[model samples]
Target: MDEETTEEIMYMTVLGCELAKPNPLRPGVNRSPSYFETLKQCCHLPIMQKEGFYRFLQLYNDSQVVVVDPESSADSIQLTKRVMYLELFKDLQVLCTQPDNVATRELGQRVAAELDVTYGEQVGVQYRKYNKTSDKTRLRFVTEGMLLQLIGDNPTMAGYSCLVLDFYEPTSNVDRLLPLLKKAIGLRCDIQVVILSTKYFEKFALYFDVPHGLTIGGTSFPVGVQHVTKVVADYCETACHTVNQIHQNESPGDILVFLATDIHVDRVVAKLRGAIPDMETFPLYGKLSKAEKAKALRSGDKSRCVITTNFAESSITVEGIVYVVGFNSIGTFNFLDPAKEEVYLRGIKDVNAMNLIDEVGIITPAGKVAATLPIDLTWYNAFNEAIKLGCLSELIDIAALASVKNPIFLRPHKTQHAADSPHGQFTAPLSDHMTELNTLHAYLRTKRNMSTQELATWCNETFLSSEALEEALVLQEDLIEWCKARLGVSEISVLTPDDKDYDVKIRKAITKGFFLHAAIRDDSDQPDQYRTLKEGSHVWIHPNSALGGGDWEWVVYHKIEPTGFQYMDRCTVIEPMWLLENDYFYPLPLTKDYGGKFWLKPLRAIIDAIDSSVPHRIGG
Candidate 1:
């Protein structure tokens, strides 16, 4: 007879309810028809039938079973016969009634039992706990090392049988392990492979890429749906405080807060402790020692808040997490100068400074970017180097006007004014290089009207270097011209040939520009007894000043020079009132006597000396 005819006859016998003879090819215990009949009505196979049926029996006898399903045919007998045969040795020991639901508790139990018997009773199945109190919730298998050990111990079992890989889903690591397992199985073809999962069966089938060798059970029903709550950085901090506040007013449960970094975790814990003195706070970061982590996990505190980073996202499950908070901002550093000179330190800046600066300007000699504010000492040094290199002409131009590609432009309105101002638009008075240049320009203008000896006297009196002043004056012209072109103005200011008191005018201008440095009197009765309020120390007029010992009633305080090798601790007191009365102040003050020099007794004495020498000329 042909193969088709033989199959047809087999189907006919199956439909006729003829009992299949026990054969070695079938590989399972054969049960009586009476036991089969018991499962026929129940939709599920009876335990006795399950033990006896070839497919179910093979699940226990052999570590692996492979079920092949034939195509449906018009001859009901043939179809039924093929199905009955296939059902006897299905890969998944699915219930004879409803065969889907492959990862159910029943399936797990059968798989576990089969593994235990085949690999020895030492084999145990693990499941992760859904509830904090429940130990066995999620199912995790033994490590590959342990599995290899089992195979070694039972060498006869290794080639003769196969292990069932059953899970809800395959992780990335599982995908990598499949090919390796297949290669191992090739050594002994007697080993069979059976994969059972609720979903991703199609993916698995494609992964294996074979015909009827792969068998699938029924689909799985949805378990209790649980929603995932995302906690951001900002939310974490706010939530931590809010939860602590809530705990203070009301009862507390387990509160979980997610921070982005370990530093943040520490900060949150500290803040919680300070804010809520009564509530207990704990930190969970990856850097924690294994023992410490275990201790934290096993804390079993009823009313505690756990502050952690993303480590708690999906890893170890914690109980009673009713509330969750996440921090959105990853705190970072903000520098003033790229060269790192003077840093106005703060937490994360509004914009990433290093990226922004590198995008706009080239690095200076100090390997730093020039910005209005120096984030660090290096940045400040870079700014100065850039200025010296002429790479950065102005801070405003670099920070505010420099062309940027795909820039994040921000126009914030000043609180003092209604109009909006672009970022980095506001300029510092004395801090800017422009202020120094302007002071030089005014000094040169005053010098054009003075004789050489007079110029020398003024230069000597003000402690101003004539050669340096000359160089600065020449550079001043170039700077003024540059400023003119930049501002779109015609004509510029220049220094004259023979101008006396040019140095004094320059010193006065420097003093005027930085009047905020005014000295406070340490003792009113003592002469030349003044300490800079800014420095918070006793200081006399710097010897460099022309009026250093001229006995001024009121002096404009600029800066204090500390005792180096030559100069002692002295403050440079310039005549600020001279500039104030002369209308030299740019972005002029609302009042002529802005900081009240008469009332400023210590400053008044210095001012009096300068005014006594000259009639306090308005302008050159």
Candidate 2:
């Protein structure tokens, strides 16, 4: 017998830092906890000492560990990325990635130009794929998600020795990556992982079974704080009260009020616009286009009021923002359990439940795959369903758009009559989803002209973001190609509402993938209110929605972000049977007992299937 030769794996040794995982079951469901309520529950994952980071660098030479700097600001991250690049550019390979792709691109390009490297020679930005350089490229800055995709294909994280993660989120990014990095370290010990986090290093240390990891210090800015004597629990109400107080009585300075959802931000903007017609108010959220977001960040106005969600928390800095009315609450992950038919209603306090898992099993291989990559179980399942439905061509694009901070549609303030005027042409009274889908279809039709200038003009005239439309189309193509290669499918048809079976195809796909987000209007007289199928919470269609009247009985939404209420957006009309047949909520009772819509036969088919599956008992 010949002796077998195999690869020897050296595991990365861990250091001491302890952070405890919050129990998924423990977060109080006492009527959606406020921002402060949730934040107070978090443990400050402590590092043993300040000098630990320097010690790790000395011993391992090439080690990847979570970088925790308690005092570091957002500016400190960019400084660290640049300082490290300058120090290590000569000898070692380096890659830096941030949570936001837009920020990543901005940094990558800035670094490229400053270094005088032929833009892509040393740095590159994707979705601007044509500008990327050859393999010799040493320093690469991208979104953490973009790099995670690369690492999935190449487990050894080829061609890069030092990897710096830009920013970390507790439930979504940091928690998901820990297990995979541990596995990767087990395979290749040479890789160095640099984590730039305010906290959560303890979880990293414990999960990897290493001693507490290193902690480095960074400078912090001093700021004055003033709290109102009154207590307001509703985020939107608090925002309005705070803005009103500041706009009316405060001194000259910019006001940055952080609300929870884009819709809420828009609402706050609307109220402020009415209250102070002379003040410059800007709504900043991920849904805004690059150009639109720049409007909020512009410096000419000395005392602008920027109403925003958490998007502005760390990423954007408006110099004159002297008053920061920050909300600690975050709608970070919109999660639903496919197995339980439960919508976490805007946000999940139970971070552990965000990942897809069976009740009994720990981590499936699929879970592990999701753990490594940045996408959620909803997207992971959607791609799986898309493959099964042979609609991977378009579903992947929608999933990609859905996964990002930047939602495809821009919610222009009501005061922008011009923007709102063009939207009426695209609005489908019963379905905001159809409205957006139609807009995208119309935009796609314009592509036949093959002129970027023509599309730009159309986008501007039509109140669409030219940059957003371009990004979505480009992302769609990339996604389809990747899916085809992965699934080994020769071709997958992209479904559109124009096709004969398009409505059914898309709705069925959404139902299969995101049934947890489904809701039905109560049979009574409340028109604007809807009861989610899983959680049974009464939510209203966002006033900003085309279908704010809430006439539809059964609808599916792209997202349900919570602030004062679970506000639905990107909703579409659907047959009630879709919910009745969803496996996650099988044998579910309908809103109606014996009679449903004229289209539905009391949901008769579902009852029959359930009855047929069980054997009749001869005697009780």
Candidate 3:
């Protein structure tokens, strides 16, 4: 073929080929140098040698790079390419090596000196290092607006440059800071972009779009290949079987598990630790304070396993991770459909599935075994088991839909009653003071029209602390506003706490908002005893609720419980179903007889009744 034809054929062929498949040149091998070399060679060709081709090569070289499938529709490809390119170029390098230590600190100081000379004194310099003693980390930088002031104050520093070095990737605040950095860089012509991390080359390559070079300083062998033979025997019985297979087959220091949530990481770690006591376990989640997360990343203990949520994906890099265990899940956001004038919690609707698939491999780097474990498969199996056991047809349908639509695996069955029961009852009794307090608040809101201060007085009279009442009110208002937004109600004119009936109104509001989480009073044997009803199926009122002081009531109706709380007990009242229904769970109509009076009605019927009576609007 002529050069033009060959170039055309290669370009067109690449457009259709899978970008995520095992390095093409190596075939069965996941990591092959030849594959990358071929990719670079292809990029150098006449037709392919362009800005676009350079981007493609950068992504190809970056072990953490996620290339949008060219076969994707033109619009999708364009959007994905833009986002991917922007991310790649945002940080030329991210240094993950610790900065508090002498060597790392000296490295930062040297880089800072170089930057000061290159960018001049107006540039900002910052350093972030973990303070192990205090269990905290600090970010000290020349603030953007103050950059000129610092330089003005000291004319001697006129030509000195600044460099911001973060020993670990700025995890918490930095994730929300990229846009600000973009703005700063755009506004200031003198600032330079430099990042330092142990895994900087791979991570920088994945997200960087500009001309760059990789320099490997220290020698480190890929760790723990022999440990692959000792895969945890208990396969994650979730829907995504890939995780289990990879965990079973992963070479030591080669696999990284990327979970969607910290809770999942904890659970997986616990399960794995139980199964393999000798294996070192590491968890990277937002909940861990920055110091803890940094320690987890830097410890570098051998035979170690790290389970993290998106932390290891692209923002930071850790060495020796060749295989990736991915839980294919996306975040949800509150969206308002303008045409319908309604608000709903929905999954990020237009997520690029190929990017998600690529994320797994990107974190592991090329020439590494990128194995995906099937955590979702376990969920699927559990859902199927629930269906066989006749738990709830609606739940079964929701599970089935989720299995098809989202990457989730149903948790395995715990116990017969625990699995079968929709809402688990509590065993504790409601305190006498709690009942009187609730009733008093309810009466004040309904009849007296009290203000928040008046209600606080009532709570004080009822023996609840003033501080506690204030905290409760704050949480109550937040929940009310959230509920209003969810229901798509624009106008909110509820009675103020100073009103005569404010107490009662607030109590009723709490009851209505958290109706699904109602708990039964623990009344042992005495049915007529007020607050002595059997702890049948009880959902604790959120501790932040005014009535959550342990007051229990047998509500005339109930609703589904909400999801997303971090520290909720299982078997608590069903979380308001609306939270999950709108975002995660799919509803299905079912016709089965529930044994209890409440169970007699279909789950949907009960939910509808609660929703309808709540006097709120629904969004499309």
Judged by TM-score, which candidate is best?
Answer: 2
Winner on TM-score between 2 and 3 is 2
- Per-model root-mean-square deviation over C-alphas: 29.6, 12.5, 20.4
User: Which one wins on lDDT?
Assistant: 2
TM-scores for all predictions: 0.24, 0.72, 0.31
| Candidate 2 per-residue C-alpha lDDT over 306-333 given as tens digits, one digit per residue, 9 for 90 to 100 | 8887667545545557788975536654
At residue 557, what lDDT does model 2 achieve? 83
Candidate 3 lands at a TM-score of 0.31
Give the Cα RMSD of candidate 1. Answer: 29.6
**Which candidate would rank higher by lDDT, 1 or 3?**
1
The 10 consecutive residues of candidate 3 with the worst lDDT sum are 345-354
| lDDT comparing candidate 3 with the true structure | 0.34
Clashes of 2: 14
Distance from true location, Cα of 10 in model 1, Å: 28
Number of clashes found in candidate 3: 73
- Would you list the C-alpha lDDT of every candidate in the order shown? 0.38, 0.58, 0.34
lDDT of 3 at 60: 33
Error of 3 at 201 (Å): 24
Tens-digit per-residue lDDT, 496-515, candidate 1: 43546433443443343334
What is the lDDT, from 0 to 100, of the residue 253 in candidate 2? 79
Please say which candidate is ahead in lDDT: 2 or 3.
2
